[model samples]
Target chain A: MRRPPRALVLLAALAASFFAVPLAALAWRAPWASLPEVLTTEVVGSALRISLVSSLAASALSAFLGLPLAWVLARVPFPGRSVLRALVTLPLVLPPVVGGVALLLALGRLGLVGRALESFFGVTLFGTLPGVIVAETFVAMPFLVLTVEGALKGLDPRYEDAAATLGASRGLVFWKITLPLAAPSVAAGAVLAWARALGEFGATITFAGNLPGETQTMPIAVYTALLRDVDAAIVLSLVLVAVSLLVLVTLRERWAPQA
Target chain B: MAPARRSLGRDAAALLGLAVALSACGGEGGGGGGQSEASRVTVFAASSLTQAFEAMAEELEEDSPGTSIRFNFGSSSDLATQLEQGARADVYASADEANMIRVMDADLVEGEPSVFVKNKLEIIVSAGNPEGIRSLEDLENSELVLSLCNEECPAGKYAAEALDKAGVNVEPDSLETEVKAVVTRLQVGEADAGIVYASDVASAEGEVEGVPIPAADNVIATYPIAQLTDAESAAGEFVDFALSKRGRAILEEHGFLVP
Candidate 1:
């Protein structure tokens, strides 16, 4: 048995304290007695529904797009591909508000595509449910792309080539061969995306505009309630934490990469 | 070696017990004494009162010995919630009477609320007024992408009332969470027009142009202030100074009506 390095020990101690203090504070102040009544409120319920529905939608959308994008980035060799990768991951670094603003500018009714959609097709982005979906997907999809890309790199290309030799088409090989091999990784990506979307605040508030039954997800509800009702904010927080934990636990069962 | 291991385990348990005790007491030996000793006044005020309220807080600090001023500026509703959650504050100044009434109903304030000032709604546009949104009627044009505060927020409610008075059937492109957001969207050309306070438009000199929405029948949100029962002496004095002539002068400078 050897002693841990001093710096690593210090880092571990600091990290442990950092996470423990907040959990302790939350437990200390939580009005556990009133939780049942608080959770049943229309505001909390509506916000929770929106949060769950949109986060799930956002995670699904991310998987649909990000996995393919990750595969391309990992396997394909193209001009300025690194730059493309950077651009795809830009939302990961950009402030969620900035991302929301960018989404508004690009997809807003008067946005580039927005203008095109409105001029010919009469589609609107502002104040619509689609706006919430767009904002969440924009922010969370980066996690999926990065995670899946890592999984793609770790996979054996020889397996896919061997499948091609057996006469499977590219799409068939990807769906039947590559996907199953990366199923855990893809699921991990989706879980990350879901968590990001669940906690998303700035982007949804900026882009979706907090309408009670419309765009007010759990985080938004927590913020709105922070002024009007302290108990509501606490309740919303517990809902958010509980939901995130449950999802993580379920994903741990299905998505955890086993040795 | 066995004794040493037992001693380490005992020490760990003792440290954990002390941690719990420290949290329960809410005060510690000499560690948090410095924070709780000097009576501090915390004022939660509306963002519109930033310039005026800050000046008042400064004056209070200069007037009272060993007194410090803490200012939290945001939407009135947010401040109200902070108080409800046992936040130590001396005074609360809301942007509107409605939010103040809500806080009063929650029994967060000490005495009867006073109408400190009044704020009138003003139409804001991009610096050039490109849309030519002269009066409320012009807002009804479907082509105009107008932004306003949501109905729940003071400014948004006022904007809605103003529009209703003029018999305008304008559909806003988006309802922002705050007045500044509406102003920002208009300034950025994302919205052709918005309705906010004249003082807010004044602050956006290079970015936006302000137009007085006819005050004859328009909504005028009355601002209210009250000291909280939990406030220490220093904070209470600070509240008194804000209601003094100097505070009125600051409000007047910011285009607020003397009550």
Candidate 2:
């Protein structure tokens, strides 16, 4: 391979350092001696539990709902397909706070659907665990859908056609062939969605509200802790950073080894 | 191709001329002989002061042309933490003494902060009192969803104090990070009720109504304003203006008690 230009290399190094500096500063300011005590505190513990539960639930929800959407987008030749794809990808670009406001408008007690839900079933999702999962899913599902859709589009159709010629049903061809072919992308997308959900702050805080052990996920906990306890906030932030780093490293090694 | 490139070059030159003209206009305003040089003062204040401070900024700017005020509004504790972390601002106005003391302890203030206004806690509900919430005890209704500020927020602390004083053991469905968020929860009807400063209800522009907490059970929040140690000359003037009679009248009109 041809060597990169020196100016390009220099620019890449500068960009790398720009990202490294803040992480270094956080590490430098971390209270390493009190990490164990801080991590084990009730606030941190509950936040961790909530973050884990909500993020996992969001990832599962994304996979269950997104797979069909991704398949439909990839295989269907329907009018307005591009518009539908754009709408699905909208949350990826929209500010999470704005997403939260939209969620409240659609799901709050007085909202269009929310009012009906409240009146008929006495169910309100605001400030509940389900609300956090909903907010997370709203922001995170696009990643899974987009990733899986790309994978589905890139797959060779001959394998499924060959299976169909062998008298296998469409469902059997999909389950026994197409799904297995796209398994790696599915795994990668699920992990990406989980990481995005774990780091979600704005939408959850705005839509679900920040209640400890219920809606106060790790990001919200870190923010609340930052106000009163710098050390605790640093510890919580470091945990999130470490988890994100792990996700990236694992994805590179398992799914994109060439990179 | 050559003509396209030539037209692009002309477009670039036109853009450069426009930029130069804009900067020239800006320079003339600052360099005019008889007028004071344009100055910008950044004030970091609590979210509860959003409307009243914006009004004060408009009045102050009108009174002294070429003087502009920028605000960074959030929870008091968040503002204090930013000051401690060396975020530069000319003035700091906290909703409670505790956060102001935190900044003072960090040596961020030029001198002692003076109490400029006081606020009392009130139960905020959606317009027309949809739930017919009338008092603090009404907040205890199991069917009602309550949102309050987290313990780190001054309004949250005040709400907790008031609740304690009233011997009301109602559990909040959500603990928001800022007082404004609690008010927002009520405004959006995500929450049946919330406890926030009286000024918040007044500033909410009738989207929400206040159910007055009896004086005996209300917690008074003392708001203090101070110029930062690194502030410009205009910062002191702004602080003085906030303590002036006109400022007091504005605060009173917004349902705050002037000191």
Candidate 3:
């Protein structure tokens, strides 16, 4: 194997230490003796449960909605397509807290559409599970969309054309050929989206409001704990770190693009 | 060869860890203005003190030319933790004594924190009081969406205590981490009612209306300010200035009661 350049290696080593030291410190001071007791509390349990449900729901919704949006952005050349794509990925750059405020403006009780929903059906999305899901989806969907779009763009279109010539319906070609070919990217995107949703804080709290066993996901729970008990916050954070590491390891092993 | 590969793997892990760490720091605002020239003072304060502190900063600068003041504002609990984490700030002002005591216990401050102001809670509703919420009991109606600060927040703790005293068990749709967030919820009309400081209601102007909490049931929120041991003499001066009559006038103008 060729030796890597020395300057690059030194710079990379400095960056590595910068990142590794803090995490090492966290692990070192994690209150190891009380970890089990702290993690077993009702608050932690509820927050963990809610985090799983909301993030999973966000991932599923992103796969369902973002996939089609990505396909359109990649395969179809239409007027203002670039604009549409920018809008789709806007949330990726927008502050999640600002996204939450936007969500409230669009979906809250006094929101433009929300007022109608309230008067007509008495359905309010604020401070509910659906609201959390919506907030997470809004913030996380952009990850899936951008990922899948990149994948779709990179796919060999000759295969898709070959299927089309075989008298397969457009929908059939999509379901049978396009989706399977894009499966790895879709899985990768979903996992990335799920991770983002799981760690989501600003938008979720801003739009859905934090209510324990209602809308208080893990991040909110950890934040609340941080305010009162640093030990509890540390334990909660350790659990999150563990979960994220597991997911990243799994993704790297199973779905990472081979060199 | 195996050792080299292990080190490479560790480097990759550290890089990934650092990426996560950097992302978190990016989310939160940092302390200090990064000024090299001129005497500088940095104050970490509760979010409720935003307006008053901004005004005080101007006043401080006017009194002593070339003395620049910077501020970091958030929930007091978060500020205390930042101090504990060794964030570089000259003075610490908290909305509650508990958080201030946490920093004091850590020996972050030079002397006892002086009570600068007292605040009380009020129920905020959107303009017109659309829900016809007239009193604390009216907030308990399951049909109305309510927001309150998180239990870890001074305002949240006080709100919970007052509610308990009133024998009202309201299921708030959201427990915002900051008292300001509760005010935002009410301002945007996302929540039918929210509990926040009277100062918040005053600052929000006509966007929200305040329903006075019965004085007997309402909890008084005391704000404490202290100079850090590591801060410059200017930090001590600023703290004294904040506790001075002129500073009290600025805070009172924003609806905080002088202690």
Clashing pairs for predicted structure model 2, backbone only: none
lDDT by residue (A10-106, candidate 3, tens digit) is 9999999998897887888688999989987766776776677678778878888999999999999999999998899899899998887787777
TM-scores of all predicted structures: 0.52, 0.52, 0.53
Residue A86 in model 1: shift from native, Å? 0.9
lDDT string, candidate 1, B31-112, tens digits:
2225656776667788777666667766766876588775555678755654443334578889988788878887888978
Give the RMSD in angstroms, all C-alphas superposed, for model 3: 22.7
- Residue-wise C-alpha lDDT for candidate 3, range B104-157, written one tens digit per residue: 998988878899999998899998888888788998899999999888777899
Native contacts retained, all candidates in order: 0.00, 0.00, 0.00
Candidate 3 clash pair list: none
Instruction: Determine which window of 10 residues in candidate 2 chain A has minimal summed lDDT.
Output: A250-259
Reference-based TM-score, model 3: 0.53
What is the C-alpha local distance difference test score of candidate 1?
Answer: 0.75
* Candidate 3 residue runs with Cα over 4 Å from true position: B1-259
> Candidate 2 overall Cα lDDT vs. reference?
0.80
lDDT of 2 by residue, B148-205 (tens): 9898887888899999999999989999977777876775578999999888888775
Going through the candidates in the order shown, the clash numbers are: 0, 0, 0
Note the Cα lDDT for every prediction shown. Answer: 0.75, 0.80, 0.79
Candidate 2 lDDT over A1-259, as tens digits, reads 9999999999999999999999998899899999999987766766776777678778778888998899999999999999999999999999998887788778876676877878899877765677889999999999999999999999999999999999999899988777777766666677789889999988887677655555778998886665434567789999888867875685565453243
**Tens-digit lDDT track for model 1 on A30-92?**
888998888877667666766776787788788889989999999899999999999998999
